[model samples]
Structures are given as C-alpha cells and as structure tokens.
Target: MAARSALAILAALSLAIGGCASQEQPATQPSPGGSATSGTTIKEGLKIAFLPKQVNNPYFDTSDNKGGKPAVEEFKGAYSQTGPSEASPSAQVSYINTLSQQGTDVIVVSANDKDAICGALTEARQAGAKVVTYDSDTNPTCRDLFINQASAEGIAASQIKLISDAVGPDGGEIAILSATANATNQNAWIEMMKTELGKPEYAKLKLVTTVYGDDDDQKSFQEAQGLLASYPNLKGIISPTTVGVAAAARYLSGSEYKGKVQLTGLGTPNQMRAYVKDDTVKSFALWNPADLGYLAAYAGAALASGLITGKEGETFTAGKLGEYTVGKDGTVLLGDPFVFDKGNIDTFDF
Candidate 1:
C-alpha cells in the first residue's frame, strides 16, 4: 500500500512537472505597482547589466554569459555582467550601487538574500533603472519582475520524488545538502519539501538534517562528507542547488558510499553526466540555466521599453522561447524542471 501511494504521488507529479506552455497561467496575487501597456519598441543600445549571486560561478557563468548575453545581443542592447566572487548577502550590494550610478537602463540580478539587497534595488529603481530579479528573488516590492525557473511547489515535489525513488520503497534516513540557508529560493523549496515529507506516503523517510554549503565547492564537498560521518544510516541526499549537488556527487563518487547512498537534486547536464554514468547518482533535475537568463534579458528589455509593466496580466515575447505572462506579485514562471539520468544525460551538452 505504501509503495502504491508513493507511485501515485510520482504519477501526479509527472503530470504537474511538464514544461510550462507559452501562454499565461492564471494570476493568484496582484503585482504591487506599475500599469500594463500593449507594446513598445525596445530601445537600441540600452545599458543592461546582470549581477548574479556571485561572479565566476559555473551556473551563473552559463546563465549570464551564454543565456543573458546573447539575448542582450539579440535585442541590440549594451550588456555587462559583474558581481562579487563570494555569494554573501551584502556582496552584491556594492555592485548594485555601482550599476545604478552608471545610469544603467536595466539591472538584472539573482539576489543572494531576499532583503539584504532590497534597499539597493529600491535605490536603483529610484534612479530610473528597471530592476528584474531572476533565478533567486528579493522581496516582491524590491524588483519590477522576477523570472522564476519553476514553481516552488513543483520544485519541492520533484526533488522529494527523486530522492524517494532513489532510496526505494523501504526509505530510511535522508539529509538535505543545500546552498546558503538564507537563499530565498532554497528556503522556499525546503519548506515545501518538509510539507511534502509530512504526508503519510513518506512516513518511512525521515529527514535527518539540513546542512548549508554556502554555494562554495569545497564547502559543499565538506558538507557532504560531514553528513555521511554524522549519520551512518543516511539512505539518500537531496541537494537543491547546482553547486551543492555537483560537489556532493564528487565526494560520494570517490568514497565508500559510492553506490550505497542515493543522491539527487538540481544539476546541470555537464556537471552530473559523469556521476549518472558511473551510478554515483541515480537521477537529478534542473531547468536550463541559459534559457532562464535568456528570458530574464527579454523581460528586462520589455520593462525598459514599456512593453509590459510588472503588473499581473501583462505579457511579453521572449526571443525564440515564445510569449510569457507576468504572474502574481511580479513573477514569471520559466517552465517546469527536467529530470536527467543515464538514459537522457548523454543527449544534453549543458
């Protein structure tokens, strides 16, 4: 009966986690400010800069360079990417201030902390720059629009499903190796994961603990090591961040726990292919980071062009990806996450 219920949950999630359509879904909460407009010309040579959680990070590198940069080029805008080397709350504040002072037309950011960057973002807005937060969000009032990779509920359910499947029906102890504890997206998903775990179907699975790696490679590797040492009976691990999942995979791939413990979470194809091939990881999931950046760039362009305000019911077309609508609280859903394993991992390059 437990097995049946678990499979039922997976079946339902399989239906829910499919790709988001190019049309608008219904809005739940209304946006705080801004009025909608039909369309406008995207100004050429507009100065648009991306400030990621940190500079030189693989995930951000792809999102900003491969995704955001090309979109900026497509729109004929002046693009610049800059941020701190560390993923700290205040690390991005100074960069935000710098971009604002440069009189940038649009500032794209993936905030490290939800509130830490709000004041700076507000100031940027006051200086006539449109603020768009992508990947990770700040408070709703802080930005013009938020480009979310996937819905929080969808992500939470999918991660739980992956770990549950990897650990088998007779689930035992599990732990979460996540990015920084203060990460807005990470915390939102973690809370929903806990809610999912509370269901009777998952009673056999106990979440032993959650450890933060601060999104640092070495620190994530050490956190993975510590989880195993601290909990000998840990049956699986769910790492919701790309850096955390990749670092944990590296640690587990070389250790005695290679095949003994299951690992799954958000990871790029290039990073998790080896682990999937070697069986260190059963499966994992993530949306295309490049596409995320691409969409963000278009959204920023729309805001700067007055094509759409951050208001709900507003729609804009992203190049090559199609149209999307602004959802409640100034949010736009990119799409659902795609899971990767040995079968399909080879087909993906990034």
Candidate 2:
C-alpha cells in the first residue's frame, strides 16, 4: 500500500516540474516595515545574507524567497540571497568575503565544498558576522549553527529502506547515482546507506556500483542510462541527489525497464511526479525545504535579537514556530524526513 502511494506522488511531481525544469532565481525584497511590525525590539535594519550552493536551483531558490527573506523582513532586517551561477565552493567563498567586508551582521550558507568553505566562514566569523550553515553543512567548529533538515542517519536509512522494499524481501543488484563525488551530504548519506544495507535484514541487497552526476541534469541522465546498460539485472537505484533522482526516473520511464527497475532518492515533488505516475519510481524522501528556510531564519533572528545565543544545549522560541534546542554540536534538526506518496502529495503544492 505504501509503495503504491509513493509511486503516485512521484508521477505527480514529474508531471509538475519536468516540463519547466529550467531553474529560476527569484529576488525578494523586504516587506514594508513587516520586520518592525513583528515587534521584536532589537537594533533596526539588520543585514543578513543567505548564500546557497548555487543561485538557480529551485530547491535553494524556494528557501531564499519563502524561508529566509520573510524571516529577515519580520525581524526588521535586510536579506539578500546570492551565490555562484553553479555550485562552486570557491565562488561561495568569494561571496562570503564580500558579505563580510560589507559589514553584514549574519551570513547563512549552504556549502558547495564542506572543507573548502570553512576558512571563508571562519573569516566571516572573525569579521563579527555570525556564521550559520543550512542545507549542506560545513565544519561544526567553523559555524555557530547548522540548520539541519533531517539527521544524516535518518535520511540515508530511509533511502535504503525504500530501495530494499522495492527490490523485494530478497534483494538483488543495486547502484547509487550521487551528486558530485565530494559533496559532504551525499557522501555522508551514502556511507550511512552502505551501513544500513549491511544489516541482516538486507543481506541480499548488493550495492554493485556508484556513479556521479555532478548535479547536472544531462550528466545524471546519461549516467543512469550507462548504469542500465552496464548492469542488466540492476534491481534498484538509490539516487541521493535531487537532480540524480529526477534524471534516473526520466531515463527509466522511457526505457523498457520502466517498472522493472525502481528509482528512489531525494527529489522535489514537482520534479518527480510524472515518473511516479508511470511507475518508474516507487518512493523517495525529503524534508520541507521552505520550512527549513523558515526555521533557519527563525534561528538567525533569534540569535540576532539576543533571544538565544548559538551555544550548544541552548533553547529558544521562534515566533509561531515553537521551541528549538541547540544540540551539542551546534546543529538543529528541524524534523523527520517527509516521505511523499500518492495519498498526500496533492495536498502539498510546494
């Protein structure tokens, strides 16, 4: 029953976003004194900069407009989202430097390369800008907060479960289609999935191969095709990246193995809907990105307003968002992974 529902949702998402897969970047300006109206008495006109891994991906674009910008406006601060045209850590470092030099009060970022961007984040902190990581995280010591959408273990385990289920109780050959070889989150999740696959319950599941898509739609699509050609008995594909998932689904949907091979991974509802409808993918998981952005803003505002410092084990209330506790490592898990399927996919527009 669960598998059937997930298949339906994936189809819906593919139909919704596949035709308009071209990335769009939207700019958000401060609402007219909406920040002041929130009535949090703090120094007025604070400036916060949000740096995503890339500027054009719909995932981060939604975060900027729906999550970060409104939170800034509610706090009577200025917010801007900027990053490179592509996911380049070096470019992100340059933007961090520029924001720091401009005397920004806070800077939140989704890192492109985890270690490569640490120095820049540390430098921003030294320049009196509170550094926070959202989406993809940096080194814990380098940033004050990490706004986690979900725990690393939880996300990876869920993907493994989805694939294990799709391949049946008696698992067979499977492969992973991942984004960039060096992606921190992807690597972490892949590792966890590997561990999960080793469990006795999944003894028959064999992760035979791994491929990189570099988060490029074309590259991912080609990689999926190559995997299919290389492994005739490939039972499932766990694409941990959003781009990889969509690309794999599209490839499978058009192939003779449409329902024979299962594709499961993290993807936006709008991007994987069609594949689900065609029964190319069984299930996938992701947190609400907009809520992630919203929570990130809430955390940033709480810190800026002196409501809560970025200390481990600290707790604070985000207006209308309820309470959150800072974990021992300065990371905050927003919530559980949202598993989307037919039953509830239509209920969520984003």
Candidate 3:
C-alpha cells in the first residue's frame, strides 16, 4: 500500500511539474462559525500578520497561500504577508515593529533567529497582539504558542535512518551539511541526529563531520565540494536544511560523485525534483508546509478571537481541522514528518 501511494505521488508530480496537466486545490468544508471554533469572531475587518523566514522561497510562499491567506479570507479578516528578503532576525524584527505599529490583532511568525526575536515578540505581545510561532519557534516564554511541524526526536531519527540506509550495512563515514550555525531548529535536529547515531542499533553508522552553509546556495554548493575533498571515504551526506540539500544535490549532480555518494535531507519536492529524477539523491523528507501555514493561521486567529486561549495543556478545536491538545509548554505538534522518495515524491505539489 505504501509503495502504491508513493507511485501515485510520483505520477502526480510528473503531471504537475512536467507540465502534463494543471493542478487543483482539494475542496474542504469551512469550519463552524466560519472559523475553527465556536464563539470566536473577529471584528468584521480585523488584520493579522503572516511572516515567514524569507520571501520568494517556494516553501514559505506556499505557506502564505495555503496557510495564512485562506484563514484570513475565511474569517473575513485582513491578512498581510511580510518578511525580510533574507532570513535574518534583524529583518524580522523590523517587520514585527511595523506590524505592531499597524495594530495587528495577531502576529504569526516563522522566526529567523530563535532568541534574538524575543524582545520584539514581547513588545508585540505587550501591544495586545497575540503572538504565535510556526515553521520555526521563538522562546516559549515569549510566544503564546508554537506550532511545531514535528518533534525534534522524529526529525533527527529520520535523517539518521536515511543516512544509514544509503550507506548500507557496512557502516561507512557520513557527514552533515547544515544551514546557519545559529539556526535553532537545525541545531536541535543535529544534536538529535548525533544522539541517534550513537545508539547501539546504529553501530554501523559513523558520523565523521558537520559543516555550516549559512543557508546560502552558493556557499552550500562550495561546502559540498569541500566535504567531498576533505572526506575521501565519506559515504553519505545528511543535510537537514532545505538550502543545503538542494545545493548539495546540484553540486553532486554535475560532479564525479553524482552516484558515488548518497544525499538526503529536508528539501522541497520542486527544488530537489531534478536530483531525485536523475538519481542523484535517493530521498528526502518534509511535511506539507501549506498545512503548517494553515494550522498557524488558525492558531493565530483562534488566539486573537478568544475562541481559544494560549494556555498550556488546553484542548480546543481548530474549526473544521478537528481537535488539538496543547502540550505542557504551549507547543502543538502538527504530526510526524512525512518521508518523500521516488515512490511518493511526485504526488505532492508543494
């Protein structure tokens, strides 16, 4: 059944991206009260802010359309999408200040720097705007709720497994290619991967090195080349950052190591499609970013409308999406990370 699902995904991708056909959105019912929960209503024209790590990245762009825009439209609330051209905390801070001045009822953000944005987020909260972090998170104390894509353990373990499978049972040297050194999510996942790699079950896998790319495509490409030169026996490269994975794949595809080395990590299907189709990368993983955006939008709106308060251990329904129990730390896990390979990579559009 899984294999069949994967084949269907690939077929859909072929049709969508290969220009074989146009894509369509799935029809979904509107949530009760025209929102996720009952008794929550925005002032006919309330405004909410949807900010991401950067603009123009397919990942965040899809989030805007599938996540924030739809929620605002459904509630008849005004929605604005803004962020830095680059994924920088200073840029995000600027936007947050602007949004606060604009009197946004809620601010939903995918933070660029974990701790640096806390001050700004606190200010926004103080100004009566409910704050929620998604895609990435800020300090739990500073934000009302964090909508996590998956648990740190799940993300780390999956990457380790992908590397182990690529290297086979012989247990060869493996290295990591990551984004900026300060990226909170990437650092947490790397730590988790290290822990998983040391377990007895993964005795055959040896992690040799880790390199940072600062999420720059050119820099990531150069880093990939450097890793190949530095680790002559490196069997696989696990890149947890989308930029790193795509850069590594692009580098390997044109180099002698194309099939000699294995590549796997968090990458968008569109960006990594060529590498996957050419067999340069075996597989990668990501959740539906659109769904992530959608959930974040709902959470932001719910918090603002008083339909649901951002209390730890609180349970509430997110309109038509169903019920969600807030964890002890005010964090909400959307679910596990979805693995994508040749089998199912084609089915998803974003």
Summarize candidate 2's per-residue lDDT along 11-119 as a digit string, tens digits.
Answer: 4334323322122212122223122232334445878889988887878876777667765666567989988977766778889999999998888898877899899
Model 3's number of clashes is 8
Which candidate wins on TM-score? 1
- Report the poorest 10 consecutive residues by lDDT, candidate 1: 22-31
C-alpha TM-score for every candidate: 0.90, 0.86, 0.87
Q: Candidate 3 overall Cα lDDT vs. reference?
A: 0.77
Model 2 is weakest, by summed lDDT over 10 consecutive residues, at 25-34
Q: Rank order by lDDT, top first?
A: 1, 3, 2
Candidate 3: the clashing residue pairs are: 6-343, 6-344, 9-346, 9-347, 10-346, 13-346, 36-319, 67-294
Global lDDT of model 1 = 0.85
When 1 and 3 are scored with lDDT, the better candidate is 1
Model 2 ranges with Cα > 4 A deviation: 1-43
For candidate 3, the per-residue lDDT at 61 reads 81
- Model 1: residue 164 alpha-carbon error in angstroms: 0.6
lDDT of 3 by residue, 266-309 (tens): 98888888899899988888765765676677677767766666
Index of the highest-lDDT prediction = 1
